[model samples]
Target: MTGATQRVADALRDAIEAGTYPPGGALPSSEDLAKAHGVAKVTAQKAVNQLAAEGYLTVVRRQPARVAEGPRRLSVVRDRKVYRDQIGYYFDQNAKPWGAIGTPTRGVATPPAHIADLLGTPRGRDVMTRTRLMAPKGSKVAHQVAISYIPVPVVAEVPAVGSSNTGPGGIYDRFEEHYGGPLEWRETVSARQSTSEEQTQLQIPANSSVLVVTREARIASGRTAVVVEVNETTMSAARFAVSYPIERDSSAGWSSTGGPRD
Candidate 1:
């Protein structure tokens, strides 16, 4: 909000747009930026923080700030059945079918003990995890962050896990195809809040409520195939619309005037 902060933001924005600071590249330190822009160190720090809040940058402990990755392009579709079930808002990306578009990366820590219990797997067992940022088309800010987990055995079914495009049919579809059955059901829990790490990764404002959605999907054979956790914070105001069908009474016949018969 201050002049120094505005200058620092402008510099960072220009760096990103011009590729001076490429994606995944580290940003200069606050002290370095202040000297470079001839502004006070406090001003530079504020500017960096502002950019981080805007989702244009990310700051990791003891590491230089960096340009945050852009959101993945996703295709949105409408489904009547899903709409009726209050799951009408459908979004997907074709770049990766069963997994990520490149080599998968493992998280540093083992699966939390609670998650292991839920999945009936042992703690510290190797698992596959993938993360993605979601945003409205043409927007630089992310609206959601999704993380998915699968046991190593389930992930082995799809070797192309990290590079295949999961378009019309996503990973769930592929699971049915390979295993010859669909998921019997899935349970999801939602909440509102953001951790400091989430704030940095998502570029959300402090204290802003984020929609946290967690899901567990199971197949008929009792195998848990997918565990998804998503955190979404809207960059702007948006609305979700849904519609569905209701049962019709068959015993009632049409009247001569085309009205329902009594």
Candidate 2:
């Protein structure tokens, strides 16, 4: 949090993000950093220490700090098939970093303005909302956050979704069983500096950035089903990769349609 240290940390972080220091490569020591940045040793050390605390570096006694390996890559297939899988499978598999989603806080409440727009509901309209904080499984720092919003009508049809535990296959499965509707999904990815709250929740340092994935799930009938927001600190971006198997065209240059035979 120190100003001088943060400046130095920012420079080194840029270098790391730019791939100047490959994973597992050693970073300059505090003495070297101090000389390079014209700052005191303690200031340089804090810079390295802060990066380590933020999941960017590892500090071991008697050795220079080393760039840490990225967290497990979270790959989500962009298919519309019943997405009944719980998020635990994505972040908690092997339980290395995120072992389980902590107890969720859920209720009927008013969603944010943008989310309301996405849900096709009036602002301040009450809807079923669920918030979760993932639990760290090992020494890994907690770095992701998820929040979901669904219209009351849908929750009324599938009451289980209003509960903290949506049970096996999750809410989508419940929707399929109770509402008998096929769902479609779309996601938008963006990046920006982390907010103060995100910094605390994700344990990232000041000036750190995060990946914001705004997702919309709709029924085949063209009704907006639900909207979910997924957040991951930029420091963890190295560990995650997003792959969309887009189709190519002979004359059109690209195909806009998603489904088979479209």
Candidate 3:
């Protein structure tokens, strides 16, 4: 990521963008790349690694790094609205294009610290987790990994959420149906370097970036909101982009900061 390494990476990226190396095409070896870029072999290798992490190239041991098949970038759009089917499948528009790689894997286990906190699970206690790996339908690349963690308290009330089959609408629908009505959702987004597992599943290289979306399912109480489930979604940052609408409001404009609302 230094000036020299980044300069080399930028040149290669420019070439890739320009079709100098078409998809699934092979790039020159590190030594050749170094000679072309007038950088050290190590610098060239770093550049290759850089582009690989950015989801451009695929690296293999003792082989030339090649362009990954498919468009260099995948634009994954995130929709804010949640939808439900009449038959009970609760989902969002963002998921319409993708399907699960397999049936959701479920288990009761101690969740990570952050997940535990989000689910309000007590330390040393376990939670029910339903995990699914989703990808664009018919695409070879994985799009995201979603894990939904439910507090034991909620699981106890609605045992279906703890099981592989949640009847019809899935966990969200079951939750709302059992709790009486609609459920509220809140999301917090952040970014981090891809984990080893994520890099393998997402087909990115080490140090690749991933976007993390942590969503909370809530129910309204008489005077407060209670969280029942936490869903964490991890997507390759190089391949996915979150989209949302911005509403125009004078009360939220810079004018509000300059003076009282007009």
lDDT of 3 by residue, 1-262 (tens): 7788988897787566444686799999999999988889999999999999988999999988999885455544555666666655444565666778867798887887888887777876888888888876654456788888888888888888887778777887778778776788878889999889887676666787899989889886556777889998998776567777777566765564686555
Clashing pairs in 1: 96-164, 96-165, 96-166, 97-164, 97-165, 97-166, 100-162
The C-alpha lDDT values of all candidates are: 0.54, 0.64, 0.78
Q: What is the lDDT of residue 90 in candidate 3?
A: 44
Off by over 4 Å in 3: 1-72, 86-94, 221-224, 250-262
Clashing pairs in 3: 88-169
lDDT rank, highest first? 3, 2, 1
User: RMSD in angstroms, candidate 3?
Assistant: 10.8
- lDDT: worst 10-residue window of model 1: 233-242
Segments in model 1 whose C-alpha atoms lie over 4 Å from true places = 1-109, 162-168, 222-262
Q: What is the TM-score of each candidate against the true structure?
A: 0.46, 0.56, 0.66
Query: Which ranges in model 2 have alpha carbons more than 4 Å from their true place?
Result: 1-63, 66-98, 135-140, 220-246, 250-262
lDDT (0-100) at residue 160 of candidate 3? Answer: 83
